[model samples]
Target: MRNARRVILCLGLALAASEPLATLATPAEAFAAQPQVYVVRPGDTLWGIAAHFLKNPWDWPLLWRRNPAIHNPNLIYPGDRIVLRYDAAGVPQLQVIQLRPKMTVSPIPSYHTGVMLPFLGSPGLIAKRSDYERLPYIAAADDSDTIFSNGNRLYVKQLGNLAPGTLLRVVRAGPQLVRPSDRKPLGHALIDLGTAKVLHDGALAEIEITNAREEITLGDRLVPETPVPEPHFFPSSPAHPIQGHIVGSLSNFPEMMVGQVVVVDQGSDAGLVPGNVLQIDGPESVTRDAVTGEHLTLPGRDVGSLMLFRVLPEVSFAVITVAKRGIRVGDALRSPPPEAPKVLGIAP
Candidate 1:
């Protein structure tokens, strides 16, 4: 009987809209007194949709908790209808209805699907000095070529026992990130140079370059190629309250824009994980009170938001998802507040 009821509920068959919108105290405030439905549109993101419906967008998991069949919520595509209704106990839940069968069948999910792809191919941060020292470095190249590219042969040192055909990525150490407040060193950003395959394995290994995104040259370090992240991931707030800063960005630009990757100072040790979203705030400044003639510190303004795609011990890689203003290196990052703001024109 329970299984039958679950099947019916998954099909979005339940009580009338006249019934009280909620029975549970907490989830009641998440939705309206009447049922609501939204049509997934092109360029729509789970985070954006959740923000449109719930008071605290990070509480999105609660909306889908009853829909166990949704193996990956990120697979939602344009033209799909998301129906919000109450269960028997008057608990609010969200269900996906395939409005256009063809659209959901192996269709590219949305623009937000692979936003993290460009930043995931190389190790984002090399925080420890010993780890940087242990990596194999490009030592010599044939034909006196100082800058190497595709189809070039190079020699590497400190390469451990590895057989031919092993693939590796060539990277150069970029900026050394330091905390904006205390100037404490966090890590060095790894700039991806190119990729190579082991041609000969010995005390000094020979590698043939296959691809080059940047100029691969001597002293470029070799680290095992990192796997690309899966396109599907749900967004949520950090499990622990995070109060960190934007130490630096993956690129040389002083100001970060949307779709650019930035490095944060806090990571897994502080309960941060991939898919956790954080808001960026501009630096607080000391200002003189106009009436009191006293110095007062003003709070930073919320400027943008980013989602962590890769996390390390003391730092993590986050892609700027929303940049309302020019986000600087010293900007602050924390969980989004519990205020509800709706995105207009998102309903079907």
Candidate 2:
């Protein structure tokens, strides 16, 4: 009896190992076996629609194979057709071959001056001092250390080789400014002091400086500005733009300002990148009930826009160039709306 039981147990184990186990059908398998066509609708995002047929929304990018027509990949419009093709092994594939209206990229010119920071590629480089630090680094144009008695004149410890008629900027030094919500420190704002001319050069240089707008004082650090290439702004597509709140900024360099860094809530998971322009909008107006005195905040109105200059896996840096109103920390952002089509058929 024992020998027979052992033989039966071994046979059961072999059968369990050899036979294909029963499992739940994946969304792709289901979609492939029973294909359904979904028409593109207004206010529908590809990420949303793809989620219906795919277990992971990020896998949507894998659907298109060598299709050049879909350049932006984010702009799928209403009345467009998105087909779901299935493979012989019962796997669904999403193919967005249909073309829609093309979105034009808005062009804007801007200038920037700063040193190119060294890029740390790997952890091994951190131990090597030569890989981490770069000499002759560009510093901010404004640094001073004169004791001011209610005057704009700035005194420096040493003028070095500063010549006459050289341009300079005035900046204040204090504890690094931190973001109120996230406790991340942003670089101090540099007040442009117009230009300066060296009157005397020695251990200290008595330079005649122009106070642009803000007050100048003592103990401000003075440094030379390094000329760098200007930054360009690239607008996003009309269909999909990201929206989020500013979190913090990066301050690894002296001239690098963190205020320019706009930390939105969206990230790589949302398909964001450097050079993508996002339209910034302010908070919605608040509506109050007359009887109970209760107030409701409506969706915020669109105000202005910004162009992302730099991007990270979770954060991005954007410059505010065309803000109708002042942009705050928690402003909303979206893709700029497409231009209205020309009317021709209707009579005037």
Candidate 3:
């Protein structure tokens, strides 16, 4: 338990030091009734932490106060101290103090672990046919080996001279992705096979598999490893209203649940970027009106929410953050409704 007077003194000092505090208009009731100081632990995510203190996790951006000097202001890591305080106007806010400031690698704020990390770090889809076909593939292996695993040497043709220590991602091309609404082609999906290093570079270069998610077989394509950086972002509504649908699943599953990645038809062209949260609705159903003998179309019920973590030209990859019911391909999505204002007194 915190000493009441001591906490009061700490707040007094923090408020005194935090000069020219920015005035926020977010309602006090949006915050937790008894918000406490939280220390970020390993495996903790920004979404999970925000959901701990706010009514809606997407409301994080409104309540979070970031330090602009940091490389990635919104990416909080383990050991950081999160403090909750109210301004003179009684508007609640969340602030953080970095405890481990010298760490080399800055971890991602959203979907950093479990099933979503691999998809985020690897190639999930390529939006162009020419781009997919231009990548180099394994032309031959030692002794004509049909399948290779970690630590096995292989030969790749068309891999051009570069360097000896470059890392590459092994992938297999899958079926073409299409928009669920009009069945228009979007791009081709890529299956992440594994990671490999360049022992030699040039046409007919020698390489060795360093990691394998699936068996690295003959003719698997190789593309330069995509660097996954800590996104300078926070969950917020899209700038403009967006209407899209779940076109496909990254895992090729018929149904999707929380923490699973799904491909959406809207992308950069639709003004979407990382950390944009959207609402999900089921497909509309047509029914017959008994009394008037008329056919009626009823809109789908609000099922859940999703956040965009990866965006391309015409499509983007999103993870299901909330699922009220089963989510599937062809389910409708739109900009989340505005948060309803609440009137409540602030209590410490």
State TM-scores per candidate: 0.72, 0.38, 0.76
Q: Per-residue lDDT for 1-348 in model 1, tens only?
A: 011111212322222212111122233433344337667677766666655554444555544556677555565556666666556765444556654333323323222554555457777678776788789999987677798889999899999888899889888777788876577898798876678999998888999999886788888899887676445555677876788998877666778788777889888988998778898999889989999999999999988788887788888888786787888888999998754322212122
Local distance difference test values of all predictions, in order:
0.69, 0.41, 0.70
**Top model number, lDDT:** 3
What are the runs in model 3 whose C-alpha is more than 4 Å off?
Answer: 1-35, 64-73, 85-90, 93-108, 113-124, 128-131, 143-147, 181-183, 287-296, 341-348
Candidates sorted on TM-score, descending:
3, 1, 2
Q: Write the per-residue lDDT of candidate 3 for residues 1-348, one digit (tens) a residue.
A: 111111111122111111011112334432334335768787767766655554455655544234333344466667667776667765544557665434654444675555555565667787787787788989887686798999999999889886988998898876777777788998776777788999998768999999888788988899888777555466667888999988877665778888887888898998998888889999889999999989999989988889888888788888898888889988999998875422212343
Root-mean-square deviation (CA) per prediction: 7.5, 20.0, 7.6
Clashing residue pairs in candidate 1, if any? none
Angstrom error of the Cα, residue 18, model 3: value is 29
Q: What tens digits encode model 2's per-residue C-alpha lDDT throughout 49-73? A: 5444333222234344344554454
TM-score, prediction 1: 0.72
In model 3, which range of ten residues has the least summed lDDT?
A: 13-22
Q: Report residue 55 deviation for candidate 3 (angstroms).
A: 2.4
